[model samples]
Every structure is written in structure tokens, then in C-alpha cells.
Target: MTVPTPQAPRHVRAVAVQPHWSARDFTTPDAFRRWMRAQLEMARPHLRPGGVNLVVLTELNGLPLVLRGGGWALRLRTFERVALALFLARLPRALPVLLRERVSPIRALQLADIDANTELYLRTCRELARESGVYLCCGSAPMPRYARQGTVLRRAPGVLTNQTVLLDPQGNLIGVTDKVHLTPDEEAGGVDLTPGDLNELRVFPTPAGDLGVAISLDAFRADVIGSLAAQGCTVLLQPDANGAPWTSQEGLPPDPARVRDQPVAWLESSWQVTAQRQIPYAVNPMVVGNLLDLTFDGQSAITGPAEQAPSLRSYVLTDPRPGFLALAPWVTEGTPDELRQAGLDRAAHSGHPLENEYREDTLHADLTLPPATRPAPPRTPHEDALDALLRGEARAPRPGTWRAALPALPLLALPLLALALLRRRP
Candidate 1:
């Protein structure tokens, strides 16, 4: 076995894939193969001889093998959770499993799928990496923490975890970054994912430069991105999945203006990290016509460095629909440890950052969708309550404050009563 050596950062092309989705994509195992094949074909041309291919979040959830119909309310989010609880309620051979696992039935079934097909995704990624000759960031999916068995990766049963696996050109597993944040939809029944240690960020050696990987909300976090850049990463790959909300425009509402345009949090988050860190950040989000009740739609893009205040102004490769590869036009030119030695990390404290000076002013990619009004993301119950309270649609004061006001209300009224008595006497 030969030890891989670091190469000087050269100009390279990177593609972010926006996967195509449909009910078939998640309905059966066979559909998964078909959908994934299409995705590979779209990404093949952009893989280039040496570069990166980023597949966005929950790529495997597309295999909704168990839950089918009912969009957000009926199937994907709520009812499926209830279904999980019911399925586990009467299982005869699950006492030991219960001790080690607390994931939903949906999550459990997905894990089972992985166990039955050990090393399937990993092997596929290895093949893709070797064939494409570019580093591949195989975004997230549900599985137990992996342990290799011979040439296969065997996952222990009931060990719940999901990760972003990185593959080199030779099909080697160089890094694994697990997800960092969970929306309320994921933790509905008081269950959540095992968060990866932010400190354990893997920096893969490549001619393209030292690359770091972040999953979903991990890219949004200031500390996380800065720490990776501080660790000397020239580029960051973030695979995200925050679905498009249910914005029903049927039978148009009397006040269409009430429907606010919702900007994607992860997209906006990508802009902040790229411009601030002065590094190329590739982000890919999952998109679908509609899943059961969930509607997933968004673009995939590479948000790289720029010189002006609008740092990512023209340096963005955005693919909003019909899955395509988002690529950068020019290769980044830099030395070994170019990003680390730049001392741009110190700029977080000072007002100046060194990396922003190098800009890719020329546009490189052609795959794109014109900008449109993004619907507001669906709010969690907590968010809904907060919004209602703020808008005076609900009155839910704290128990302590309400209780405190009870006695005070009567006491305050006594002054009014006394004043009325005095005025009558006068």
C-alpha cells in the first residue's frame, strides 16, 4: 500500500449535483437504482479528470421504501413517526435492539436496507470516484456507524448514524462527516441523530487543495466553517437537505401578498461562509416534485470566493431544477497548505481576511434556473406558536407572569374603585 502524498492546489472543476426525485425514487429498492443511475449520468460529464462531485443531503431517504403516500402531514413527517411507534410496540425480538436504538421505524427500515446491502453505496461511490477521476463527496444517508468486513462495509444492527463519506480518485474512503443539526420534523418523537464531533473534521489531501466536509446545517455554523478554514482547508463541501415548503397557490387566496417569499436557509448560509472564509464552498440540496406530503425543490451551487462586497456575485453555479452539475469555470491556483498558511483565520478577529482578494470574476457554469420567489420554509410547532404570539394571534404568556398578574389585576382595580368613591362623594 502506498501512502498518499499531498499535491499543490491546481485549477480544478467541481460539480454539485441536484438529484432528481419522484415517488418512484423512494418507493422501492429497484427505483433507487434507476434514480441514482440518472443522477450519475448527469454528474459524469462534469466530474472532470480531477475535481469534486457533491451529492446533496438525505440522498438515501429517496428510498422511502416503507412510507409512501401522504405528503408532509400524513406521511413523511407525522404519520410515519406514529407508524414507527406502532411497529415497534409489539416486536418480539427487539428488547436487546431497544436497548441500543431509539430511531423511528422509517429510520429503522432504512438501516435494515443498509445491513442487507452492505458496502453497496460505498462500493458504488468507489467505482464512481475511480471512473470519474475526481474526489467524490457522497452526501448523507441513514445507517449504523460503519465497520468494514473484508471488501464490504458491514454495519452493526441497531447502531443508528448517518454520515457524509468522502472518496478519493482511487475509490478510497478518506473522510466521514456526520450531520450536525436536526429540524423538528426529524426529532418529532423525541428522537434525534448522533451528532458528529466538529473537532474531528477530515481534511483530504488532493492536488486541488486540502478539502473539508460539512453536512447540512454544519455549513451554516460560523464556528464550524471558521474552524475548518483554520485547519487549512482550501475548499469546503456541504451537502444539505432542507425541503421546499407546501405553498399551495391553488384557488388563490384573497391576499396573495400574505404568502411571503421564503429564501432557503442553507443557500443563504453557503453565501456567508464562502464570502467570509474566502474559500470555495459547494452546496447541493435535494429536490423532488413532491414526496408523499413533502415538497423538496432547490438549486445546487458552488459558492466560491469573489473580490467585491458581493463576494459570490458571479462566482455562483446554481442548478435549481432538472438535476445538473454545478461547476466552477477556473481551477484554483495555490501552493501546498495555501489556505492554512494564509492566516485568514485570524481575520475572523481582525476586520481583514486574506483569501477574499482572489476572485473568480468570470462565470464558468451553464446549468441554471432563473431566480423566483422562494416560499417561506415550513415552521415547526414551536415556531408557529412564537409567530402567533408575536402577531397577537395567540395569548400564551408564561405561567409565572400570568400567575403574577392575577393578584396584581385585583389590586390595581382597587385604586379605580377608591377614586370612583371619592368622585361620588365630591
Candidate 2:
């Protein structure tokens, strides 16, 4: 008798999971590895050709304990000071420990933490990128010294302490962008550091596409979103560690108000202008909790050029089924002229809506362009002086006097001191 052969399972499209939990919650490294393996098991069936598995590792605060073992407990009180000293003293040793512990099956990972841990966190991420074929990205900011009530002292200051970085499979730095805006207290000098410029924006080139990520809580601003959209940023990841009031209110926490409002604004603004909508992810809580309890509020979607109508897609994990959010495969293309036109349109529209008087003026301004041709003129002495200034040459009132003062001051000081000493002898 002949037996029938079983057919192999059909392959499905791949989806990325943004699990908002920490890797260190697992007691042992092996347990963490098992958790990662299990995640892969759940996602494997859906893995498809050219698909990406992106996981945002939330709640990485316990990383120090996970990598250093129970030994970290002894220095818990002075963890910041000790961790800094240890990291500076033995970065060579610490880097390997971090890579071995944090495990995930995702093609890319984003880790968020407080500012003090930025150095050690990035170093470990760099090492992990080398060993694993996954890309790693980090986001951080200086801790706030004062809470809403009063003065609070955050230990780490403006020390390159808070940052988000991406690491390629080879562990080389692919992209790095600093957090632009800070929380109210952070900007108030509660942490002893100056806030970074909110205007600094960057887009990273990835196999997936040109991923434009903004490192600011206020990235939800309409102007910022419009600007990034104009610049061709499709994926906007907002990794926020703002817990307590933002996540919960009166002991009952639903989705955050800001989180919900921002993504909606991004969708509406991008859709109206260019049709290139953004996929916005809000990685919140920044700690370990019941996956079932945690809710991803914003829409997980993809948008195309203005010519294509917007399609709204949302992925909500109501239960622990362990599925992924599948995105339509992306292909790189030339910079869309529509994006530039949309940007210009937005800028022209952003002026005071109440000011009807400037309507004609604004229209005229938008339509005008500078002349393409100009005549070259001879350079005058004043022009030469201005040119020298532009080139970064010193423009002192008396060039020689200022230049000679440095060496002359020391010689003058010694004689003055000697004369004073001689006079004091009486």
C-alpha cells in the first residue's frame, strides 16, 4: 500500500512586532534567549522574502542588573557613579557582556533609556550589532533635576549621556541623532545640561527605505511633521520614556492623549499635502508590564505618493496571539517632486490664518523666484575684509598688538610679581 506525502506549509508575508517590554525581565540570559526564540517561533510562519522583523525593546533599565548579575545589587545606591566609573575604566570588558544578554529575533531594535546610561548603552549596542545581524537604535535624554513640585537632582548632566543610535549587523554606526526637545523640567536646568536644538533632523538610509526618525517628544508638532514629510521620511519612531501621568490618570490608564493626537495629526497633514503618510509608533512605558495590558494607540500604516489615495491600516494586539504588523514592501525611487511642492504649499499656508490682508502678498511671494543670472564685480578693501572674516581670519583692531599680547602678558606678569615681592620685603 502506498502512503500519501504531506505537503510543506506555505510561506506568508512577514510582519514586525513592537513589543513594549524589557529583555532583562527574564531572570537568566538563557531565559531571555528562550523568549527571543519563542518570539521567532510565533513570527516564523509569517516570514516572507524581503520582509523585515523590527522589535522595539522597551524597559531596558534593568540591563545593568542583567549583564552584571546580582553583583549590581551591591552598588545599587551608587549605580550611576559606579556604572560610569566602571564603563570608563573597563569598556573593553563591559561591551561583550551586554551583547550576550539582550536577545531578540527582530531585524532592527530600538532601545530607550535615561541619559546616564547612554554611553554604556551605545557601546553595548555597537558590540551587539557586530555579533548579531540585527540593527540597533537608541534614544535618550538628560534626566530632569526637578519634578513638577520642586528641585530634584538628577546625577548625570550634559555628558553625551542621553542618545539614540542605530547599529548595523557588523556593529558599525549607521546613524546617530540626538533628542531635540526636552521635557519641561529637563529644559529648566534640572539636570545641569543645555537642551539640544529641536531643528536638527536626519534621515537614515536602510535596506527597508530612507527611514526618517525624529528624536523629540514634540515631533508631533504639525510643522515638524510637515518638514520631515517634505524631506521624504516615511517611518517616524517616537520612543518616549515619559511614564506616570502621561500613561495613566487617576489609577486608570488608557492610551495617552498626546500619543493619540500626534499620530492623527501626522496622518491628516501628510495625507492632505503629498499622500506620503507616515507610519508612527509610540513606544511607551519604557518598562516591563503585561503585554496584554499595554496598548499601542497610534495607527500602524503605510502611505504612498500623492497620486495614490491614502490607505489606513491598524494593528492592535488585543490578546497574546504573537503576530506581527505586515507592511507593504518598499522600493526606493527618485525624490518625488510632489513632496517639494507639498512642502512649499504647507509653508505658504502656515502664515496667520486670521490675516486676510496678506493673502495677495503671500500668493505673490510663493510664485516669485530669484533671477538666475548676475554680474561679477571687483572686490574692494571692505569686501576683502568681509571675505577675510568669512574665512575665519582674526580681525583685531590692531592685528600685531592682539597677536603679541599672549607672549607679552606672561613676561609682564613675572616682573610685576617680582617688583611686588621686592617691595613686600620691607
How many backbone clashes does every candidate have? 11, 7
Q: List the residue pairs that clash in candidate 2.
A: 59-286, 130-171, 138-164, 138-165, 139-164, 145-152, 145-190
The sequence of per-residue lDDT tens digits that candidate 1 reaches over residues 296-366 is: 43334566544312332222122232212243231232442442333232212223543222222111132
Clash number for candidate 2:
7
- Against the true structure, candidate 1 reaches a TM-score of 0.58
Per-residue C-alpha lDDT of model 2 across residues 13-58, encoded as one tens digit per residue: 2123223333243334444444434433433443333433232232
Q: Which stretches of candidate 1 lie over 4 Å from their true place?
A: 1-9, 49-96, 99-107, 147-158, 188-191, 246-261, 264-267, 307-426
CA RMSD per model (angstroms): 20.6, 22.8
Residue 313, model 1: lDDT of 28
Local distance difference test, each candidate: 0.45, 0.32
